[model samples]
Target: MASIARPALLRQVCNAAPTRRMASTFAGSSLKHPSPLTRRPMQSAFATPGASRVAAFHASGRRPILPPLPQVVDGDVNKPAPIPEPSASHGSYHWTFERLISAGLIPLTIAPFAAGSLNPLMDASLCALIIVHSHIGFQSNIIDYFPEKRIPLIRKGSFWLLRIGTVLLGISMYSFETNDVGITEAIKRIWHA
Candidate 1:
């Protein structure tokens, strides 16, 4: 099939009128001739002459007048805002700990193969770190997509699900390491196979 030029294609679309099908869709609808209420300009309660409507609303006792907003005092313009106290469990410390785990994994991953033997402790540590890293990544995703403010129930459910899954994964990993070949040995066997 021959392709039309961009300009010609645009001109063809712009010049085309609405089809019979499109016009017929709205033929029986009130949309063809809108009501006078739709034609009139919108009036606000605060605007002049519209204030009587506000009075009428109050007279009818439908809704009470809202209280004024609380006044906020401005501090010095040049001075910086007060810094929040840091906690070890969250904020920068949590981020630094995650980074440390990620950096530690690189050496732990290479050391087993390079040394030509799988240390059980190193294998266990690597597996634990990977699980923690995955949990953190999934937690970040849950926080981004299902925020507490937007979908509180879903966010709580996802967090609980993540916790449960991580626990199950850890239990399974422990079982795998104890009952059969550990992660490193399994990988080596698979690689040789």
Candidate 2:
């Protein structure tokens, strides 16, 4: 078959398309003819005038009159609020410490490999840093899954247990540093073995 030009095809398609118009009809008894209820006022003339429905409710000894609600967009109506978190004051400092410690770990890790061993002070410091980092990670996990509000005892107990474990591990690490190979050398031995 021969191909039709684009413009000619478009013209033929447009010409063949049916024109559609929408039609709407209303009932004879619609708003064009007013109802009896619309012709009369809803409330009595003797009812409280120049008063809101809520005010009228107050006048009738029903609801107590409350102060006007604060507007949504008014800055004063919505004052500068305190942070909603319970420990907001301490949170930023804690986060900064966590970040500083994480940064330190990069150097600490590289130093051990570069030096091929650790001095007693470096060994103990690295051990403490690792323990602290691990404790932070475990504590964060416990906080996420077991909220203090729901299980206060469990949360506190878990944190204390982590602290105890860290201390015990630190003692073991120190003992190894004095009596045997330190952390770096021990890792090297394991890998070589």
Candidate 3:
């Protein structure tokens, strides 16, 4: 589904039951408003201390899984606030990168058809874009599966491993383009054989 559709659905569901008569409209739907009985405190079902950890982790930026770090005993009430890291995936840079990849889909799909005719530069460009695209995708998966806060060593190691692999693959692609047929022509020849 397109990204815009999700927000539109949310809007519809949110505005659907503004009035009592409109509440009946959503009667048979899954997006019905909650009742008073279901308005209890959002507690974990297990009653274990760890059960609420996920909720707390999400509520605060810090992780609840690990023990808290010891604070400095020095009374420094005027201590400056720590600087926040610039977010790569939240602002304009993220949107531009996303759109560039989306636009490149056309070239990625069409270039393979005429692979034998494309120049080495074009082939190398396509290969680099594909590698970068794949790296971004894999990085996202890594971020989701192995967050740095939870597993610092594994996360950093995995990211560096991916970077090294991408560089090696890019070099190999360039060598292949220089020595023999580039990626598109090679794949085309494979299909013919």
Candidate 4:
């Protein structure tokens, strides 16, 4: 009895409605009847009329799992790559500055200990160089981890935070040198203690 009723129910559902509808109801009478392939799906009766499409990942208002890639203009593959404009600051100059700081550190680091006393000027220079080296290293890490193109907000925030931290450290180091025993002296005391 149940097997005979199931086929009757299936037939009713299959023949219930037309697959295609007149477009005059939704679209402004320009299209009389749209083909089944081009017709839009009917909205759920419970869904709001003005509801906007939302991303599945960002539905809960959290950051995206993966950052979006930067847009690149596609060009002819046969064409040769364009030459980049010359800029010393972005190229050799920045690298040269970092190398100089690194090289200066070895001598400045040795001079105070060799002399058995810290000259205030030499100590200050050493401190400044160390700070600059650390800042450069941290800036590189931030750039690598949080790229400006993909995650601009995070990258800018990290940069500003780094700047603030560098400034605070410089101020504190200056105060430590002037107000009390200098960096070398403090390190020596700590080493002996």
- Model 3 misplacement above 4 A: 1-84, 87-90, 114-117
- The candidate that wins on TM-score is 1
Error of 4 at 58 (Å): 28
Residue 94 lDDT, candidate 3, scale 0-100: 80
Is candidate 1 or 3 superior in lDDT? 1
Candidate 1 lowest-lDDT run of ten? 12-21
Per-residue lDDT of model 3, residues 129-164, tens digit only: 888788888888898988655677889999999999
- Top candidate by lDDT: 4
- Residue 131 CA displacement from its true place in model 1, Å: 1.2
* Candidate 1 lDDT over residue span 15-133, tens digit each: 22222124234565435334323322333223423223344446454354654344445567676876768767988888999899889889988987797546788888988999999
Query: By TM-score, how accurate is candidate 1?
Result: 0.58
Candidate 4 per-residue C-alpha lDDT over 1-193 given as tens digits, one digit per residue, 9 for 90 to 100 = 4326666434333322231122114543324433322323343322313212222224465455875577665566686777879887877899999999999999988887798658888888889999999999999999898976567899999999999999999999999989978888888888899
Q: In angstroms, what RMSD does candidate 4 have relative to the true structure?
A: 12.1
TM-score of candidate 3 against the unseen true structure? 0.53
- Pairs of colliding residues, candidate 1: none
**Alpha-carbon lDDT of model 1:** 0.68
Off by over 4 Å in 1: 1-31, 34-87
Alpha carbon RMSD to native, model 1: 17.1
| TM-score versus the correct structure, for each prediction | 0.58, 0.52, 0.53, 0.56
